[model samples]
Target: MTMKTSFAFALAGLALVVLALAPLVLPDYWTGVLLGMTGYVTLATAWALFSGPTRYVSLATVAFFGVGAYTVAVLNEVMPYPLVLLCAAGIGMTMALLVGLSTLRLAGVYFVIFTFGLAELVRQTVSWWEVNVTYTMGRYVFLPFEGRHIYWQLLVLAAVTLLISWAIGRSRIGLALKALGDDETVAAHAGVDVTRIKLLLFVISATIITLVGAIQAPRWTYIEPSIVFNPTVSFMTLIMALLGGAMRLWGPLVGAVPLFLLFEWLSVSFPDHFSIILGLLFILIVFVMPNGVLAKFDDLRKGNRA
Candidate 1:
């Protein structure tokens, strides 16, 4: 409606068009890099959708992600690819619903610890099932999709996620979430249906994350619990979301791109020290830009205007 809003939407649309055509023009190596970047963009954005508003700080990203990948690995042989994705979403939503109902009541560090533990629990469970029942440590994924296809799918997912996040930010539920973030007691007193709001957003976030994992599974070709359900995925997503200013719709995108590039470089240049550097970066972000780069920038802009 407003000129600024119309201009922003136009710019976003142009960026999306350019990104969608990226695979055709980009070299193989760069395309691969872009694919990975897009994966994180989707993950971080989805993570922020729930965590940013409610300030829940969930670490269960990999649980749902691994479930999605594993779902594809197990059922791709028997079911259609689209059906497998749907199943992954369904499983993710169910898991999130159960977990949210039980743990959303817990706040601060307790919620954080439980979510981290939940990912580990899912990983261990999958590992046990493979070892005892399947008699295999990992499953191979055989699909017709290539890196470009996966990249496109992730790109689309990321776009949809951004759109959904933006839409939610403009809705009544978004206000409820923000109020919940500020003070759960006050929000409930104000008739916000706190539990329902948190659970709904959490499930939506988890389902998107699951779909991301399913879309990306074929790229791995071989997925084990450890590989698919790596804890680093959870941490990286959290760091990115926080770094970008999780409270803002486009904050995760800002954080994910730069941090993903930094991680890529660190992984290659200092493979042994990569984890240490990641930990250090996380500490630095928490101390230096706890409200995220976007918030910091906004603060400076306001100060200048004043």
Candidate 2:
């Protein structure tokens, strides 16, 4: 590797080491906060993996995330934890494949609206099944995982996601995705398999999101369609990714940390108005920093150099 590449790897390794050791030293509350932060970091980064270069703006994140959580809730009692996770991944992959095949052809706002609707459809379907067939509204997850365990798992997953995103960003597929985002017609004319590429990335991103939900299920202890399939998850993932400038590999992480903390504070301090504040923040970010905070920073740097 070149010097710059080597330095980046070294820095990433060091950061991972530090994060890995954090739960061991931190208090319970802080560890929980870190766990929440790590979860969003993974979600936002994975969301960006497909939406960033492709500009798909998916709101189906909660659909797969809820699937994973429910998968674990349904099977955790009978299967080993690792096997439950594997099953969740399989189910998530299948769902993503089906959704991607059906919807990848639709672009722009249609795709966005469909994805948002997908999460609601899944949530409502699950709700109906529970009420009509299962005679229950929720399932309990009784895994032996503590907050620290979940934190470590999320940290590892976040690191893996970052590595995968970085790898993809350096690959030929990345170039095709950027081109596809710029103009789908031109990209297809240039011989890029637009449909296949979009489907592949969407599946990968959705699967990771599923795994995140599965791993986080134990933290909730009790899972229901409404709780696990919250639409806020989708909106927050999008906002965080966009705020960080999803086009860059590390942009989601940059946006997730501070926003997650701010969100936590808002929920605690202004529980009644948290949703209103979140909506306002979303509007502000879209209007003032449409390209994201990182993009704005880049513009400033370029201007200074000029």
Q: Best-fitting candidate, measured by lDDT?
A: 2
Clash total of candidate 2: 0
Worst 10 residues of 2 by lDDT: 297-306
Off by over 4 Å in 1: 304-306
lDDT string, candidate 1, 1-306, tens digits = 899999999999999999889889989889899999999999999999999988888999999999999999999899998898999999999999999888887766787888979988999999999899989998899999978999999999999999999999989998888888899999999999988998899999999999999999999999889899988999999999999999999899999999999999999999999999999999999999889999999989889532
Cα misplacement distance, residue 49 of candidate 1 (Å) = 0.5
| Stretch of 10 with least lDDT, candidate 1 | 297-306
lDDT for model 1 comes to 0.92
TM-score to native of every candidate shown: 0.97, 0.97
Candidate 1 — number of clashing residue pairs?
0
- Candidate 2 residues lying further than 4 Å off, grouped into runs, are 304-306
Best candidate per TM-score, number?
A: 2
